[model samples]
Target: MTIQVGDRLPEAKLQRIRDGVEVVDTPTLFEGKRVVLFAVPGAFTPTCSERHLPGFVEHFDEFRDKGVEVLCMSVNDPFVMKAWGESQHVPDGLMMLADGNGDFSRALGLEMDASGYGMGKRSKRFSLYAEDGVVKQLNVEAPGEFRVSSAEHILSQLP
Candidate 1:
């Protein structure tokens, strides 16, 4: 089932490039923290690279000032995610995470088949606000659309 408001995020492990690919569990990452977790279909894709990720990087401080940690996830390896973050000049605080196997995406019911685009199984473009591990809001963009999941939109929806 798709995760909904009031639903606690499923337990899973995610990878980030810090300290040579550190692995973090969902509970530890979200525990007692207000977070904006946004997923892109794949790293380095046109819209994801040019707009989606950049929006979060630009507005990262706004979210931090509000005590929200911004996380960017993609169905790519940690190396690609790290390179993309570096290419985009992503700020220190915004996290670049990898759901390489789409396990986390599948667990959230946000995995989508992108084989038609030569990208196998991937994550849908979406953003969710979670506090202390429970979801408070979700914005999922339609296929080939980029509106609701943008940082400006997610920032505006903060409680």
Candidate 2:
């Protein structure tokens, strides 16, 4: 089943790049925080590189002031995620997490088959708001659509 508002977030290990190295499990990062977690299909894909990530980067301070820790996830490995985060100059408030084996994506029921694009299985574009590990809200886009999960949309839903 798809994750929904009010559900406790699934517990899954994620690889985060810390000090230029890949670190594992790291779920404690969100244990006592209000987090806005958004996922994209891949690291450097057109929409993700130009639009999706920049939206979060540009709104980093606003999210922080609103007590939301922003996290971006993708199916890429930790090295790719690290490179992409550095390339984008991601702000400290924003975390770039690697769902390398798609365990987290699959757990959220957000995995998509993109084999035709040669990308194999990947994540659908989506965003969620969590408070101390329980989901507060969720915004999921229809396939090929981008309107619902943008920063603006998420901001509008913030209390």
lDDT per prediction? 0.95, 0.88
- Write down the TM-score for model 1: 0.99
Which 10 consecutive residues of model 2 have the lowest summed lDDT? 21-30
Clashing pairs in 1: none
For model 1, residues 77-98, the per-residue Cα lDDT tens digits are 9999999999999999899999
Candidate 2 deviant stretches above 4 angstroms:
20-26
lDDT of 2 at 112: 94
Backbone clashes (count) for model 2: 0
Clashing residue pairs for model 2: none
Q: What lDDT tens digits, residue by residue, belong to model 2 across residues 1-159?
A: 888888888888888878666565535766788899999999999889998899999988999889889989999998999899999999876889999889999999899999999999999999988888888989988988888889888988998
| TM-scores, one per candidate | 0.99, 0.95
